[model samples]
Target: MRKIYNSYINNFTGLSKEIWLLSLVTFVNRAGAMVIPFLSLYLVNDRCFSMPDVGWIMTSYGLGSLTGTWIGGRLTDKIGFYKVITLSLFFGGLGFIGLQWLDSFAGFCIGIFTLILIADAYRPAIYVASDVYSKPENKTRSIALIRLAINLGFSIGPLIGGMIIASIDYSSLFWIDGISCVIASIGLFVLLKPKEKDKIDPDSSIKKEGLPPLLNKLYILLFIIMVLTSITFVQYFSVMPLYWAKEHFLSEDLIGWLMFVNGAIIVIFEMPLVGYLERINISKTMATFWGGVFIALSFIVINITSWSGVLIIGMLLLTLGEMIGSPFSSALALEMAPKGRKGSYMGLFSMSFSISHIFGHNGGMNLADTYGFDTTWWIMVGVLIIVSILTIWLYKLLKKSPTFEGT
Candidate 1:
């Protein structure tokens, strides 16, 4: 028993104090982000917006996210990550709470767009921060550790947010979310003292000949895969809440627990699994392929049975895929980037997710609102199959390079 405990804890070693501290800050920041997981619920239940209107508001969210990542990524490279993260968190938090005042469809569309643009800037900036803090040998594990904090935050947030909704009102979610973000911003200011300048080797750090990610054919294909994969994944937070309530008849708190379960599994197992995969020298893309396949199966499993226990089973498979797939996808993006262009690479990569939010939220809601829940799950399964096929193409395309297998 003691040996097992030591081995489990050992998986998390070899990271810098900054990554851990950043992880703490990320935890608080994302916990406040609980407001997002419940955004559909608020619009549908409290605000009484129709499905199409909610879809438009969410579409604005994706547009904002796309622009924000573009700006944040560029700014992190120019001004520095500390400034980007600090400013994004502080202002974005205020914007989230300020959203309580908006009512009309156009107002929500514009408001969510602006707020998400500011909020999502924090995404790619944190990716760059992870790169700056980690050593090459343990980079994937380092990212997994940061996600460890994020998943832990996600786990706690939904459970509490559920209880709050059950007892009080949705407005309370906005207040707590905003306050926690402000606290996280203050923590960032105190804990992560910035360097004189971002340290990079001058020789390697000079801009490479190809500054454009679109110019690289392999990368463009990879971007397509990421965008598709994210569309299927985005449905989890966007439409699943409605699916659970309207279809399965779950209460607010139960739906929260289900989401909490997804985060909990990732928090407990992702780091150790990443460590084990690295030690065994598995191909990163190969792991990602399996991850996509597992997630695809997760959606299929939902349609397999009417039992509530099926949700638990499906959640486990989904978590397994997420743990295996997400870090490697991130590490692969980092690996492909030239030394000086890490910010730009991550920005484009993060934009893939933003694009997914645009398609995923609006599309999933439209289908659910029109057809029913089962059709949406089946369609998501089909989309994920395309992601899996793209991953295979990327895997084969990289074989000519010596580092293809490792990357």
Candidate 2:
């Protein structure tokens, strides 16, 4: 056991103090966030709100995220990452606590807006900090490790929330979630003190090459690729279960476990696979991985009639694709960023998912409802193919672009 542990520790090179701290912060932040998937349920079972009403309130949260992501990205560049992360935790905690007093739909909406806005605001801060703290060689692994922490928290948080909800009232879910956020906030507050003063001035550090004149350049192209892929990504949570429940005849609990399986696989396999994948070029690997994902995702479209076997196989492929795509996306974003604005680059990357959620959820639901789950699944697969092609093309464009040089 000791030998295995030592070997594992030895494999980690260039693991910085800041990365470790950021990972811990991510873990804590995600633990609090896991409560959100259950928020709709709490509104229905506890708050006496209708499903449609709860959905509108949830929409407010998405709006908050849209605004918060942009605001957070700017704030990370201006104020500093540590402060933004601190506020994220503080607001997240406050939002959870506010749920205690929530009675009407409007009250719930207000609380959700506050929680989502603040909670989302901190994300870009964390991403920028992680990117800044990292060197190029280990950047992919570092980001993967950070994601692993978030996934770890995701793995455990839901289980704990389920236990709490089963044993206690829905109110306890919010109370515990609030406390977790507070504790997470305190951890970040104490540990992640800014070292900006120790570093060179931002302007002196790396002079900014003012905005790239054309918005239709490589960076923008990459953003579009991500958005396309995210159509399938967001479906994992939003409509997949609904489709499974209605058509595949899967139980909600089973769907949850499948998601749990996805998370668990990522946490287990992500780090070990990092080195092997790093040996390949980022663009090629991304294309290949996403291609594989699309092919596997195609399996989901076939009507297997049995939910268990087919769902598991398709979801497993989806998870594998996710494991490949996520870290690669982060690394690619960092590579594409201009100097002194890693935060802004990462912030835009983060928005891909947020935007997808807003559209993908509503869109996928509408497609599934109007057409069928198979049609929706096939459409997403087609989108994934577009994403892969665009990613490869963008990689070529980025290689040729003059802006590749960091000013």
**Steric clash count of candidate 1:** 0
lDDT of 1 at 392: 86
Q: TM-score for every candidate vs. truth?
A: 0.97, 0.87
> Over the full model, what C-alpha lDDT does candidate 2 score relative to the true structure?
0.69
Instruction: Look at candidate 2 and tell me the lDDT of residue 42.
Output: 60
- Candidate 1: pairs in clash: none
Note each model's CA RMSD in angstroms.
Answer: 1.5, 3.4
Model 2, span 118-235: residue lDDT tens: 8888778777777667776788788888989888887767666656666666677677778878888889878877665436124226666556312536667777777677766766
Off by more than 4 A, model 2: 1-11, 40-58, 100-110, 198-206, 210-216, 246-253, 282-303, 402-407
Candidate number achieving the greatest TM-score relative to the actual structure: 1
Q: How good is model 1 by TM-score? A: 0.97
Model 1 ranges with Cα > 4 A deviation: 198-205, 209-211, 403-405
Give one digit per residue, the lDDT tens place, for model 1 in 1-407: 99988889999888899999999999998887778889998999999998878887899999999999999988878877888999999998899899998988889999999998998898888998898888888789888988888899998999999999999988988988888888999999999888767362221346554556777787788889889988988888878888788878998899889999999999888888998899998777888888889999889998888887888888899999999999998888888776677777889999999999898899999998898889999999999888888898888878777755556
